[model samples]
Target: MSRIAFTPTRVAVLGAAVLLTAGAAGVAVASGEDVTHPGKRIGTQDAAHPAPAAKDAAAAKAKPREAAALTGSAKLFRKTTEDITFTFDAHLAARHNADPSKATGTFKFVHLEKPGGKGGWATGRIDCLLTGGKVASATGIITKTNIKEMNGSRVGFSVHDQGKKDRLGYSWAAVGGPDGTKKLTKCNSAAPFEQVKKGTGDFHVQPWKLPYPDPR
Candidate 1:
């Protein structure tokens, strides 16, 4: 019998032929193996079952409730039909709820005699703040005032944010305040009566019931 010599070239040709046969059989060829331990596959975890894609960060976050509220500062500048200009400026720190407790901030109300250049003002600290929708109400204890009657009184007012022109209602202008009386309304306001002539600012109402504290 004649002996056949299998050289390195023949060995290489046989290996290529074996690979082609394995590929035809739909066999998964290992691209990499453990370097320390020869013949051990690197990725045994099912390639078909790939790790799930990372969850979308925004979609994974919980959505806020429909009743979630906000709190912040607000201001309004308006003029009445009687040629009296009123300005309200407040820096409120109320919470997301309508409760009067823990409401801390400052409030100021100023009025200018339109034709005449005379003016009076009242300034104080906020005691109460309530809001619902675009309307809001705020009250403050009068700490200082140029107007004698307003001294030691708590002022309250309501605001309606109507885009370009806002509506405002003052405590004294609500009921015309009684004549020569020390009794002043506190934490009470009327519906929006006077439209703003020119102003800038906004209020975000908290979640609450309708008929938002109109004590007029």
Candidate 2:
């Protein structure tokens, strides 16, 4: 048996590379965005697995609570905004599921940003919490990850600004399931994130933003 050699001419190389990337179905990887890990431990942990009925009830109760106090731009963007397809460094500081304790990790996303001039904006998606509610993943666009799981495992994140000013904003993942009902719990119902400005735009290379084939 002979192994096939893979070589290509430069002309269609870029096009072929794109096609190959597209064919790889969004298989995820770690991101490197946040440089000096920021943020505080704002998560909790739990050993008991609450029933779906209870979880739903908790989500219902927590929704209003989060809304009532709205901290960052998460609230406004969550409704009127949609994630743009781009690359960015996403910093994450997670906590325990049973106790919602603080943990960290670097994540990469085919990030999505809200439409319109985001005063400078960025958006990213991650698997975050696992089914057992034990693992929380944070994949970034490029570079390396600074992800530190609740168990103390850590990864670095690499990211860059696409020349947009809005500082890298942060939000919380409320619930993500098989159903389309997955929602991102805003870090601040009022301002989920601080809108970055133009002189503050950023971007990266390694973890390129996935192409989200949808209308703006």
Candidate 3:
């Protein structure tokens, strides 16, 4: 056997080759791909360390997404300086420019002008609904009320959902113009006003890609 000489030039060349191989491996790790195996990714799911696909699927099934609709009840008001209270259940599809026939719900409003005194009360049926993002606009017709003039008149409501501290507003405050004045039109609601001091219920607001409900 011939003896191999350990020359400095040969040692340097070997070191450079090792460095090149290491650089290639670093590039593969940074790219997040397995160059040696096409169509195979290097991540939580690998050949030797297979991912738990069944477990992931089960978790997704357990926490299903909620359908986009407003179906629940809420008691709104601060009960202090702003003593007007509203309690109602709204069940309607978030349809853009939907007709009054497509909505169904009821609402009761009370205003306590004096502390611990009998206040005026009004009840109505929801006739129209419109929703976008986390906001819902609704309208109703007053069927019964202690205040004579309010009976038979239409009312508007706007809701801004924020978990348990959601905000709400009515047409008298949120809407303006020909519909808000002398005659409060149906299905017209502007931006929400920070009026609700207390809130309870669900408002699964969803975008309805259509025009506002017809005011006719």
Candidate 4:
């Protein structure tokens, strides 16, 4: 019996065949394009690319909602004839000396002139009760006027407190307008409140709520 020795050419051929088979298998796995399985493809379904419009729509949905428009009645009052002032009590004093105390004091929205040269005017008085008091008293014709957005309206006005001079400030948006069912919404002061002069001791009454009607 003759023994046959393996030649380098034969060894190279065998190695090449093994490598070709392995390379083909590796490419199929890496490409992830299995024609046999139509459902399978490159990358992943869950990680699929998003359309430009779809991305934009998603961003729009995430954005904050636009605020409601002001009421017709609220649109009437465009000016004030007198100076508007906000009195602060101990609570307000502690908050920033300018913060109108939800605790005690009075917020008077007085002499609010009508819009469109109507010449009609109104007033509002919000009475702050003692600490822990429920439903403080409010009065005056302006009281009926919506200073907030809904029942309230956001109006640009000035604050004439002691510490802060006449500085422009805006009231919170009320729910309904003056004619709306939800009347007299709360109007919290924004900004410039921090600039108000700090007060101490018992609550004090200050002459605020001056109005200057807008010229028609």
The prediction achieving the highest lDDT against the true structure is 3
| Higher-TM-score candidate of 2 and 3 | 3
- Which pairs clash in model 3? none
Candidate 3 lDDT by residue in tens digits, 10-98: 99999999999999889889888766765667764655645577668878888634223344445555545435566655555434234
Per-candidate alpha-carbon RMSD to the true structure: 22.6, 24.3, 20.3, 27.8
Model 4 scores what on Cα lDDT? 0.33
Give me the displacement of residue 170 in model 1, in angstroms.
1.2
lDDT per model vs. reference: 0.56, 0.29, 0.64, 0.33
The sequence of per-residue lDDT tens digits that candidate 1 reaches over residues 26-116 is 5334446544345767566456644334235444464443232223333344344234433344433323344453456666655555545
Ranking by TM-score: 3, 1, 4, 2
The segments of candidate 2 whose C-alpha lies over 4 angstroms from its true place after superposition are: 1-163, 172-192, 197-200, 203-216
Q: Write the per-residue lDDT of candidate 2 for residues 102-196, one digit (tens) a residue.
A: 22223332323454433322233332222111111232222332321212222122122233432233233332211121242322211113343
How many backbone overlaps does candidate 3 show?
Answer: 0
Model 4 scores a TM of: 0.23
Model 2 has an lDDT value of 0.29
- State TM-scores per candidate: 0.50, 0.17, 0.52, 0.23
